[model samples]
Target chain A: MLQIKDLKATIEGKEILKGISLEVKEGEIHAIMGPNGSGKSTLAAVLAGREFAKITHGSVKYMGKDLLEMSPEERSKEGIFLGFQYPIEIPGVSMVNFMKTAINEHRKHRGEDPISASDFLKIMREKKALVEIDSALTSRSVNEGFSGGEKKRNEIFQMAMLEPKLSILDETDSGLDIDALRVVANGVNKLKRDDSATIVITHYQRLLDYIVPDVVHVLFDGKIVKTAGKELAIELEEKGYDWIKKEVDSE
Target chain B: MENDQDKIISDATSGEYKYGFYTDIEIETIPKGLSEDVVRLISSKKNEPEWMLEYRLKAFRKWQKMKMPEWAHLKIPEINYQDIIFYAAPKQKPHLESLDEVDPELIETFNKLGIPLNEQKIFTGVAVDAVMDSVSVKTTFKETLADRGIIFCSFSEAVQEHPDLIKKYMGKVVPSTDNYFAALNSAVFSDGSFCYIPKGVRCPMELSTYFRINAANTGQFERTLIIADEESYVSYLEGCTAPQRDENQLHAAIVEIIAEKRAEVKYSTVQNWYPGDKNGVGGIYNFVTKRGICKGEYSKISWTQVETGSAITWKYPSCILKGDNSVGEFYSVAVTNNYQQADTGSKMIHIGKNTKSTIISKGISAGKSQNSYRGLVKVHKNASHARNFSQCDSLLLGDRCGAHTFPYIEVNNQTGIVEHEATTSKIGEDQIFYCNQRGISTENAIGLIVNGYAKEVFNKLPMEFAVEAQKLLEISLEGSVG
Candidate 1:
């Protein structure tokens, strides 16, 4: 469970997220549809506790705790996963070791014992199969020399490994091909449970086709301008964002 | 613009004195001055031969006559020899049966450095020569190294026991008249490791030297000489740490290496002197001369260094290729953090035809540090078909750090081929965000990027030293990277 009250975020003192309020319960998939510069990614960054952007006035409560007070790592430990649009290329850190450290940090934060190396490898293999990722990528440095599709799929692969309670997919579907998109969608769809939730942020309705959402919201000028069922995403794709903007202007 | 000014102001601050440690131990230090008498006293203390004493006096006179060179691209104050006590040796009475005979203070020093002499000597079973201040106190695994016909001893002992070897090759590659600091080190230099790999013999295991400067108001002028004879091979490693001090202490050292026909010499150094604090009021002023000569045909010399300390570093470890088909290589990774300044590089001289040399340098500057890579490639008129390749890259962790590259290329022969490349990069916030989104924290992300930037140089270090170097790099850039 999470609550966002009048969330307004700014980067370089320019307002990006303007007075947005929302609530998400357990086991729900929320699709955010918007055009470019719609503050979709800013919303994810604000939730994950990026320090650069300032939260001028907002209260974000996650599981009855203040999310703004935590660090980026602490937010991660609290089960907030933000799948990056562009993955970083860490040249010498092997993907397996990186994933292992993350899993252990999260586990340690939760007061659980560290996972055994054998168990880590076993989990890696199992989840890696869920995302249909090639095992060779795990041996190289994290995202170093990785293709665009492989990078997106690697994000999903990491999501499956961490098993977060709430996952934020910020434009994960931007660079993925159809097959890779299917693989990523299947991975997210498979990892869902009764206690977990997903917020799929996207510009098109194509991603919503794979991972259908319970609610679709349209974001414009740093504010959510419209809310509808899954057909809203389909309607925005058919009629374009200008129609939505005109409707908001009329309101 | 604000970022640039922050970097400029921070660089103006100077380096740290992280390695200043004091222990209650008796030390036989000379009077705080430099003269012919001081050199004579140092030689007499070792009971050296007449020729050796004469050599020191000659070096002292030359040093007195020569002024310190100001041509280096470093901001350093004038060093007053009168203010520096040139000699300091631990008075625990040097004797070597095992690590147990080592001083407890020295053992504590090594432990703080993360290289426990007792554990390393017992587990990995490599001999350790512990050099505190300016003298070598104990040497481990002597019998094994000696069994292989490899002569390992202190320079003082070498002067006494094997005068022939010392007289034959002393200062041959880099003579006492070579430069200002080399001459200074030659005058009042205390003691350091001396190794000679005999013909056709492979050294049994790694030979290590851990140098520490414990005394305040004292300069460490240590000398190390290693010679690998024909058909022989040697791999030498050196590491240094100093106690924290506010006033910058002077460290001027000379390291000479000679590789004969069909021989290979590998020398690696991890210099982690106490870098100064963020304000950069005090640290070590490292002025060193390290050079090697490939005398016989097909000889090889390689230098690998991980320099992560010192307020100011000025050194050039070079090689003179004299034999046809000889090979020379230099791999270096120099990192300066929190007001540190380093000006270092290498030189490769091609004299023999068809000789080849390779230089790879990686510099990481964080928290307003200024690190420069200055190198030279000179080919003689007779060195037809000689070749050289140089690559220098730098990674700036913050907007306040600076990295620079200065390369000199001289060619006299029309048939030589030389290639040079350089690049500078910054670790931007976007890069960090990419890693954070994938669940990797910022610190781990920094470590990964830095390690990746240093992989080329890390490959040159020995496997064990490579691990330690990586760990040191990650720890050194602790607050800056994150």
Candidate 2:
């Protein structure tokens, strides 16, 4: 469903993601485990078309279309969802209104009529139930004064609302307690489908316990140096990334 | 991406002012220049009483001695007073008994402005008094208002028919010697609205006045006076627009409101004078003095204004809480774009014990415009336990624009509780990108962010005025979303 070939991204003249290539098919959960400053977030930002990150030399094809050519909004309309590590707090825009505008814009891009008010509310209720988010939290301004756990769950709630074909969860478990981690992972697990794919980017292997990945890739020095089955996460968690760094250094 | 944002800003700043069309109406204007004879001409032309003429002469003499204020953070060029026409009135039937008697061109002009003068077509429960150039052409629902002992008429008509009320209340709140603009407005002010709600009576409908400036070189000095008698309640609205011109026109207006014992008054304004072109060569110099006085115990007065036009705006709609336990409020949203400059806020003077006041001012500056919020909260020695809360927020759209806040607070009584807060923020790229990622366009995203930023003040306006104010904000900030 998504393809990246030698993707090199830079921000402020400093290369972050250097010579990175990955491919993910439908119904697959790919976990990219890396240490700090390993360019895991940069890869997600590049896929989401963040304007600040410049793609120095790379090709990202999503559903057979060049993703780098599209704007951030167009990428969103094309079903590319990037769950930000630090969700932005917009003080005045209510989550309900934000979702309505997003849904309608996506529908407009697809040549479909706007969803009716009743249908919209029903979908909101259904999505709220999926993520176990409080209705009051969803009614307020987007992420304004929201708890850390609530913000992560709200991201999942939005993912459920958008129903994107390719979802990239970047450090979704960061700052989340065990209970919040379980709720968020369960929400993502429930939304998984045969035609959709998930890319879980994390610094630790703890998040993979709840939302198990089919393929685990270790990213070191802006390149994925190791790829293995789910058992690789357990081995890395037991042995640590230092051993992997030593191996990559020698290679 | 930066180029895309620059394009958006340029497009928003370059959007045309939609209400810049002039009506081709023959106007009878006094020759340009100001003098004793000119003031007398305006007074006599309105058929003012001898007392009114003496009042104008007194104000004119005071204005002659008073120099234009230079303290505001504005770069105002020296105004050539001798070159401006003091009065201009559209030529029409002298007396109008019904809508049909009014000139067709005048009716068409109002219709184009979406203000229907025809009583039957007015779906909202609003009585409108239409003022063009110098004179008030018509005031709708006058007889219906008169049935309830509610006096709603033109200032000229009040001077002629209800001289006692005019004599007792005129310049009582905002005196003729208030300031430079107030003195000037008092001298040459031709016509405006006069409304009086009787004791214990609530105005049946919202009272509104639409002012338009059409004649070239003519300065519109309108005077509006509203009085809510003891136990009475009323809501008054004012709106203004001017034609596009190469030479800046002057709009110096005076509005005075009085709320008696247990009375309540809500005054709202949507000022959309011509804001000149992108280069800021010409527009309206809107120097207005609007004040309300709570004169009796438990009285309440609120001023809500959305000022989005004019090349240079210097206005401070203030309130004087003179009665014990009285309440005063000032809510404003001022927007300036493309070389427009505005220095506006409100003054809350707490003179009575235990009085309270609130001020919420939001300023949005885009393009090369500069917007400043200058406000003062003063509590006298006797005003013990007087409380005041003030919040002023400024939003900048582009790097070239500027926003400033000047809040002055004075409390003589130790028990007075005063709090002031101010914040200035730009429309950050992250906020824009967040909205864009949600599928909203940059234009709509700016609108949403700006509206949300000014939502507090917008909520204080009447429903219709709130909608109009939002639209004006969108227009004023159009294409300014870099």
Candidate 3:
């Protein structure tokens, strides 16, 4: 469902992603293991259509269409969700209002009538239950005073609400506690469909324990240097990025 | 991202003024000049009493000797008094017995403004006094109000019908000599609404005056007076709109209100006069003086305004708490887009013991506009146990715009308690992108953030006025971001 070839990206004249290539099919999950400054989040941001990351060379195809051609909002309407590492805090915009505006815009794009208020409330309740998030969060301003873990869970709740075909989770498991992590993982697993795909970008193998990956890739210095099965994540977690750096530099 | 955000904000300022259409009705206009003779002629044209004519003549002489005040943070262009037409009214019968006798074109104009003169067609439960240019076209629900001893009519009618009340309270709150604009308005003011609720009575419906400036090369000077007697309560609304013009049209108005013992008065304004073109070539110079007084113990007065138009808006609706234990409140949301500039706020003067007041002002500036909040809170020596709280917040949408606050507080009594808070915030890039990533457009994102910022002040407006104010905010900032 997605393809990337020789993706070289830069920000502020600094190369962050160099000659990267990857592919993922439907019904599959890919775990990208990378150390700090290894361009994992950069890739996610580029795929999510962030404008600051200039693609010096490469093309990304999603659902057989040029993904780079669409704006961020258009990409969202096209069923691509990016779980931000740091969810933005928008004061005075309640979660209900934000979600309703977003859902109506998506409906408008799909040639459907806007959702009724009662239907929207019902859907919001269902999504909140599915994500195992507090109902109180939806009544407050969007992420204004939410804790780090709550913000991440709110992002997942939003992912559940939108029901995107492709979701790129960028460090969503970083600040979560064990119980919160379990709930987040269960939310992702529960929302999984045979026609959809997920890309989990994380540092360790802990998250992969819950959401098993179909394939594992090790990235170093803006390039993925190794690929294997789930065992690769365990090996990396045991030895860390030192071995990956040694192998890549020796090449 | 910064460049894209700038493009979006600049795009927002290109929204066309929606109420900038001129009617094609025949109009009668006087010569362009300010003189004793001109003032006398206006009073004579209205068939005013001798005393009313003398009032106008006295104001004219005062205006000639008073120079325009330049204390505001505004770059006002010099206005030549002799270059403006003081009076312009639609040519029609002097008096109308029903909506059928009104000119069809005039009716169409009011209808276009969503203010129906025919009472049967209105569902908003508002008693309207529709004023076009220099005269009141019609006032609805007059007899219903009269049944409860409520006096609701045009200012000219009040002078002729209820002269005692007019003589007692016309300039008690805001005198003609209060300011440069007030003097000019008092000298040549053509027409506005006058409302009075008798002692112990409650006004059945909202009293409103919709002012439309339809004639070319003319200034609209309307004087509104409202009085609530002992134990009475009334809510009055005022709305203004003007046709588009290449040269600036002046809109100088005066509003005075009084609340007697245990009485209450709620005054609201939604001023959407035509702001100039994108280049700031032309628009209304809105200089207005509005004030109120709590005249008896336990009385209350509240002023709520949503000002979204006019090229230059210099207004401060204030209140004087004269009775012991009286209350005063002011809530305002002023928006400046394109080349508009607004300097507005409120003033609270505590003169009696145990008085209280609260002020909330929100200003939003977009494009290359300038918005300022200037307010004052004063507790007199005799105002023991006086309490006051004031909050002013400013939001800026673009780097080119500006937001400023100037708050003054003075307390003479040691027992007085006052608190003031002020803040300035920008429409952050991250906030906009967060909404955009959620499938909303940049324009809608700006609208959401702006409305959220002004929600506090908007909550004080009545239900219908609040809805219109929100829509006006959206339309004023539409397509700012692409």
- Per-model chain B TM-scores are 0.94, 0.99, 0.99
At residue B375, candidate 1 shows an lDDT of: 95
Residue-level lDDT of model 1, residues B1-482, one tens digit each, is: 24533443343233323445666677888889877888888888777788888888888889889988887777788888889988888777555576677778777766776556664446664567878887887777766788888898888878888889999998898899899889888877888889999999988788888888888889998889999999899889999988777888999999999999989999999998877667787788999999999988999999999999888999889999999999999999999887789999999999998999999999988887799999999999999999999999898876767898889999999999999988888776666666665556666777777887898889888888899888888778765653
lDDT of 3 by residue, A83-156 (tens): 89999998878899999999999999999999999999999999999999999999988899999999999999
In the order shown, the candidates' DockQ scores are 0.42, 0.61, 0.77
Sum up the clashes in candidate 2: 2
TM-score of each: 0.94, 0.97, 0.98
Candidate 3 deviant stretches above 4 angstroms: none
Reference-based lDDT, each prediction: 0.85, 0.92, 0.91
Docking outcome class, model 1:
acceptable
| Candidate 2 C-alpha lDDT tens digits along B1-482 | 68767887898888678799999988899999999999999998988889999999999999999999998988898889999999999998899988998889999999998799999999888999999999999999999999999999999999999999999999999999989999999999999999999999999899999999999998999999999999999999999998999999999999999999999999999999999999998999999999999999999999999999999999999999999999999999999999999999999999999999999999999999999999999999999899999999988888889999999999999999999998888887777777776677777788888888888888888898899888888888888976
Off by over 4 Å in 1: B1-19, B94-121
- For all predictions, the C-alpha RMSD in Å is 3.0, 1.6, 1.3
Runs of candidate 2 exceeding 4 Å displacement: B1-5
Higher-ranked by TM-score: 1 or 3: 3
lDDT for position B236 in model 3: 92
Residue-level lDDT tens digits of model 3 in B358-453:
999999888889999999999999999999999999888878888999898999999999999989988887777788788988888988888888
